[model samples]
Target: MAWAGGQVNNPTQADAMKSRLQAIEQDLSKNWEKRDELNRTAERASTELKEIQERGIGLARSLYRYSAKADSLQTRLQQMQERERSKSAAMARRQGQLAATLSALQRMARMPAATLVAIPQPPQNTIRSAILLRATVPKLKDEATRLADELRTLKALRANIAGDSKSLAKTMADLEKERLSLSFLTAKKMRLLEKTRSAEHSAATRTARLSARAGNMRELLWALLKQKQSPELRGEDFEPPPAAGKPETATAEPPTPPRQTAALAPFRLPRGPIPALGRIVTAFGAKMPNGTLSKGVYISTRPSAPVVAPTKGRVMFAGVFRGYGNLVILELPNKDHVLISGMAKISAEIGDEVLAGEPLGEMAPSTSSLPKLYFELRRQGRPINPLPPKAARRNKVRG
Candidate 1:
């Protein structure tokens, strides 16, 4: 009877164990599905971020091109003003010459021909006077012809100036529209970035704080790496509470590239368009008004000039830092980096691969009439004078 009871208990135990195994398998499958869904959501967010970034860049480029057009129009208007001044002076001189010539003709007409010629001292003198009068008639005719031509030219110049003024006004209006569009796009991009960063922060299972206070970029990077590598607890143990407004579905995303060293390795020299569209206002190492030496050159440009990439590389950082408004740093193929700051807006994003001469951003508006950009080049974390010896010869401010 005891042996029979033992066999019955063994069968019951086996069935119970099978039921527990099935339940465990179901839980494992659900966890895997949840993980996959989270990964897909991250990918979609990344895609959205990239799309917004690219759209912002396109708008910025358009704004820059329009600003350039306005500058060119203004320059042409100035030239027209100068030409008008010169022509006005020439017209005045022609008018005076014409008045004198007409007066001489009228005097000759008032006096009888015989009286005019007879009073001259000798027969030859009278003949000479008559000959001179005949010659004066032709000269007067030529002068009148030249004066008419001058008047026409003056009239044309005035008309051109008026036309140019109108055209410039229209161009400026268009530029204003572009500026507004770019502003809107930039704001949108910033919002998107903020949203993405927030989402990433929330989604991360473990986080590291490098210091009690907010840290610099280097420290932020280190903390981010540490957070990524930290072991995450089981969902039932220490899982993050379900976020409010959780997305329903997620798409898969490519794995993010591993972070590289902060310092770029030096490669080839920059051989593309210079970073800024302006004249060098201050050279590298120049004394500043604040009594400090400048690490970068200051380029003064027309408002909102397009700042382009000087070489092919990936963007390292693209955002404001401290007082360096809208700063962008590009890591070159060989590890050199170029820093462009003083931008009104940034178009690129971190890890974006930018081509040489691609538009990166636009100059910010200045308190003065023209905006200024601060540009620098560094190799292996050390800044060098970016302006080459031949830069002076090659430098040109674009309209």
Candidate 2:
């Protein structure tokens, strides 16, 4: 009876252990599923962010073109209006002159031929007045012809001004439309950034602390990289492979390469096109106001001009730095760095993988002065000219 009882207890304990193992397996399966779902969500968000950025950039370009057209039309309208005012003033003066000449001619015509003899005036004086009147008739005729021509020109100028006003109105409407579209895209991007950053709040907090403590950008970057390598900030944990005898139960699909590779692969040098639509006001190595050689280029951009990434890179820093307003630093795949500064707003966040031409930020809107963007490319911690070879040579020659 004792042996039978022990056997019964043993079976019950074995059954309990088996049930617990099954529960553990189920939990592991759910966790894997959750991870996979999160990955899918992240990928979708990344793709959506890219699309929104591309569309926003296109709209921004359209806005710039339309704004330029509107400016041109406004300038032309002002010139035409000025001409109209000048023509109107000239016409008014001509009318006064013509009226005076006509009145004198009428008085001369009304005077009877007998009156000239009856007035007891000298014959020489009367003959001289008659000769002057005869000469003035041709002059008056020429003046009338010239006034008519000016009136015609004034009419044409008014018509052109009206046309330009209409064109300007149309261009402004298109610009407004593009601005609205860009605003929508920008909002979407912000929302996506918020979502992406939410998951890494702890890491971001740690990075922020590091940034605060670091003395400069170089120190900050080094600290960030070091923190990223730590387990707590890695945000990923992988289970060791099953022991040799066990069969593999799950396989992860290899990650697809980033979309920016194709666009970035062709460039041998880190320098791509200028990151924004603007004129380069200060070239690399130029003398700055402080009498120091400029380490980067300064671009005089239009108000609220869209700023894009110059090349494919991962964001290392995206925030304000000492003396630099709204700065961003990108780490290229080849271990190079690019720094962009002086933006009014930064759209990219730290650790974001950005593509070439991806919208990164915008210049501040300013009516008083054109905003300037600063761009620098660094190779192994040394500043290099970001201009193309030909452009660099041209700048050198100019200098």
Candidate 3:
């Protein structure tokens, strides 16, 4: 009877252990699948972010070029205006000369040709004077006509400049609108990235804590099984005897509540946008040629691009740190911190509470072909992998 009972109990125990192991494996597999999905989503976002940033940069460059063109046009217009003023002065002098000439002709016309010839003592001298007057009149008439044509040309030039000025003003307004739109889109992308990262961080933390608790439980079970003494099984381990009228298969087990561990504690965190628009030039933990690993990432951006606050945080330190120029450190609400370095200038001061998307500074040497910035996110004074799991795995394998 003892041998038969032992055989039945052993199979049941073995089957239970096997089922538990299968369940654990399934949980692990699901966790990995969720992580992979998240990684893929992050990659897509990063790619789209890069494209949006590029578009923003292109718009900014266009705006700058157009601004220069507008300035040149304005200067040319000013010169044309000056020329117009000078032409007006010349027209005024021409009008005065024409008026004097007309007055003299009127006076001469009032005296008849017969009267003038009768009063003159010498006929040959008078005839010469008349010939000179006739030649002078034609010359004055030609000069007046030439001045009129010049005035018309000046007026046409002024009109053309005015038209160009109007067109340029319209172009500038349109370009400004486009630039503003790009800025808005870029800001939206940054917000999306921050929200995704925050959610993923929370989920991952909970999963990791749960996995650790599960591992502890498995170890405890193994130790219990290995003990030489036969420990009394708790009443919770045994199923109640089948009810008198109901078949065993018909009795349903009550579901247990989920177990919560201390590690699953929640903390408040601020969600915000990325500091700048750029491409990831170097990833975290990259092995350098000098055999040292990188603790943070480097982003390549356009010259003079703005560096903004990634969250609502207080500036802990805002100065140059060794090996990192123009650094600004922000301490977040949960005590997690972020370091922004390699800036051209610093706008925020220490102890200043900066809002998300607030400008911290402009990128240094904004015209570099590849202006790089260093960024790090930290928790409890330790740097963790900020990249998604898939990218981290690939990077690790490559390394």
lDDT of each: 0.62, 0.71, 0.58
- Pairs of colliding residues, candidate 2: none
lDDT of 1 by residue, 1-37 (tens): 1246446457677777789999999999999999898
lDDT of 3 at 156: 99
Sort by TM-score, best first.
2, 1, 3
Quote the lDDT for 268 in model 2.
Answer: 24
lDDT per residue for candidate 3 within 9-67, as digits (tens), equals 57677788789999999999999999999899889877776665456445544544454
**TM-score of every model?**
0.63, 0.71, 0.46
Q: Sort by lDDT, best first: what order?
A: 2, 1, 3
Listed per candidate, the RMSD to the true structure in angstroms reads: 12.1, 11.8, 24.3
Question: What's the true lDDT of residue 203 in model 3?
Answer: 33
Number of the predicted model whose lDDT against the real structure is largest: 2
Question: What is the RMSD of candidate 3?
Answer: 24.3
Off by over 4 Å in 3: 1-19, 114-132, 196-399
